[model samples]
Target: MIALIQRVSSATVTIENETVGAIGPGLLVLLGVEKGDDQAKADKLVRKVLAYRVFADADDKMNLNVSQAGGSLLVVSQFTLAADTNTGLRPSFSNGASHQDAEHWYQYFVQAARAQGMTTETGRFAADMQVSLVNDGPVTFWLQV
Candidate 1:
């Protein structure tokens, strides 16, 4: 499992002009499920996303985790994150999981995050989503498990 997390002041996902998911003062999580990824990987990645310290603290240091900063999470399924673009102009999806498998793990990850008492929102799986965000500090991280 892979996650590209961005600290954001606000974020939203729209499907056909309908706002499907939105958040304020949160992390926008672009989640990807690769071949061979499973529930354990999803669980580990979710734990890391919640606990990874990327928020600024009282001393103006990036030492606070999302939960500690009282931030919500907007998780979006993005298989493109697994694209193998290292070799050619066109990216390959050879490393990405099948749609069915990816969706299963994606949902499991969201449920696990919510189960951990985090404020979580999500984009519809397989939907043509338009995601918008005000990236605070433009801070981003790529995490994998």
Candidate 2:
């Protein structure tokens, strides 16, 4: 499993002109599941994302987790994160998990986030989604497990 974590002042996910999920002062998470990824791996990634000290504290040091800073979370499924382009111009998604399997893992990841008591919202799995965000610090990080 991989996650492209972006800190955002606010974020929203829309599909077919309808807003599906939204969050404020939190992280915008783009998740990808590989063929061998499982609940344990997804769980580990979620723990890392939640506990990562990416937020600044009162001293202006980046030493606080989202929970300490009282932020929300927006989790979105993005299969492209697992794409490989070493061969040519086109990216190959062969490393990505199948759609059905990916969806299952995605749901489990979101559930894990929710279990942490954070306000977690998610984009529709496998849906054509347009995501909007006002990036906070324009901060982003990638994680794999």
Candidate 3:
């Protein structure tokens, strides 16, 4: 599983002109599921996402986790993140998990986030989504598990 985690002051996702998910002062998670990724990977990634310190502290240093900073989470499914673009101009989806598997893991990840007592919002899987965000510090990380 792969996650492109971005620190955002605010973020929103829209589908067909309807807002489906939004968040303030939190992490925007663009999730991608690859072949062989399973529940264990999903669970580990969730834990990391919650615990990873990307927010600034009193010292103005990056020292606080999202929960400690009191921020929400906006999780969005992004199969394209699994694209193989290292070689050709075109990307390949061959390494990505099947649609069924990807959706299952995506839901599991979201549920796991909520279970951790965090405010979590999500985009519908497989939908054409328009995502907007004001990236805090423009801080971003690509995490894999």
Candidate 4:
């Protein structure tokens, strides 16, 4: 599993002009499931994401994790993150998980985050989504497990 995480002051996900999920002062998680990815990977990645220290502390140092900073989560499925772009000009989806497997893992990831007591919001799996965010410090990280 992979997560392209961005620290955001605010974020929202829309589908067909209807807002599906939104968050303030949190992490925007662009989640992707790859071939061979399973529940263990998903669980590990979720733990890393929430524990990632992108938020600032009293001295303005990056020292606080999302929960310690009192932040929420906005998770959105993004199969394209698994794209293999090393060859030619086109990307390959061969490393991506099947639609059914991807959706299952995506839901599992979100539920796992929520179960950890983190406030979580999510975009619909496999839906056409429009995501908007104000990237805090423009801080971003690619985490995989």
Candidate 5:
């Protein structure tokens, strides 16, 4: 499992011109599941994401995790993140998980976050989504487990 997380002041996901998910002051999580990714990997990744200290603290340092910073989460499925781009110009999707597996893990990840009492919003799995966000500090990180 992999996640590309961005600190955002606000974010939203739209499908067919209808807003589906939105959040204020949070991390925009672009989640990806690889061919062998399972519940354990998903669980580990979820824990890392929630505990990552990207938010600024009172001393003006990046020391606070999302919950402590009073932030929510906007998770979006992004299979492309698992693509193999090291060879040739065209990227390969051979490393990505199957559709069913991907969707299952995606939902599982979201539920795990919510189960931890985190405010989490999500993009429709396997849908054509349009996402927009105001990236706070333009801070981003690529995390994998």
Candidate 6:
């Protein structure tokens, strides 16, 4: 499993011109699930995401975490994260899980986040979505498990 976490001041996801998920002052996590990922991988991702100290502290240092910042989360499934472009031409998607398998892990990832007390919102599985956000400090980080 992999995730690209972007700290955002605000964010939203729209499908067919309907706003489906939104959040303010939170993190926008673009998630990717690879072959063989299971419930334990989902658990590890949630725990790490929750504990990651990306938010700023009172001293203006990058010391606070999402839990401490009282922030929310907007999760979007992005299989393309696993795209391997090292070859001469087309990127290899073999590293990514099958669509059905990926969706399963994505849902589990969301459930794990909710279990960790995050006010998490998610994009519709396998839906065409338009995501928009104003990144806080333009901060971005990656996680893998």
Clashes of 6: 0
lDDT of 4 at 37: 95
Q: Taking the tens digit of each residue's C-alpha lDDT, what string does model 1 give over 31-67?
A: 9999999877887898899999999999999999999
Quality of model 3 by C-alpha lDDT: 0.98
Candidate 6 — which pairs collide?
none
> For model 6, how does the per-residue alpha-carbon lDDT over 67-143 read when each residue is reduced to its tens digit?
89989999999999888889878888999999999988898889889988899999998899999999999899999
In model 6, the worst 10-residue window by lDDT is 82-91
Give every collision pair in model 4. Answer: none
Where does candidate 5 stray beyond 4 Å? none
Q: What is the lDDT of residue 127 in candidate 3?
A: 97
Writing each residue's lDDT as its tens digit, candidate 2 over 71-145 gives: 989999999999987899999999999989999999999999999897899999989999999998989999999
Candidate 4 Cα misplacement greater than 4 A, ranges: none
TM-score of 2: 0.98
What TM-score does structure 4 among the candidates reach? 0.99
lDDT of 4 by residue, 1-145 (tens): 8999999999999999999999999999999899999877988999899999999999999999999999999999999999999999999999999999999999999999999999999999999999999999989999989
Preferred candidate (TM-score higher): 2 or 3? 3
Would you list the C-alpha lDDT of every candidate in the order shown? 0.96, 0.94, 0.98, 0.96, 0.97, 0.93
lDDT at 74, model 3: 99
Q: TM-score for every candidate vs. truth?
A: 0.98, 0.98, 0.99, 0.99, 0.99, 0.97
Candidate RMSDs in Å, in order, are 0.6, 0.7, 0.5, 0.6, 0.5, 0.8
Candidate 1 lDDT score relative to the true structure: 0.96
Tell me which of candidates 3 and 6 scores higher on lDDT: 3
- Give model 3's clash tally: 0
For every model in order, what is the number of clashing pairs? Answer: 0, 0, 0, 0, 0, 0
Query: Can you tell me which runs of candidate 6 are displaced by over 4 Å?
Result: none
lDDT score for candidate 5 against the true structure: 0.97
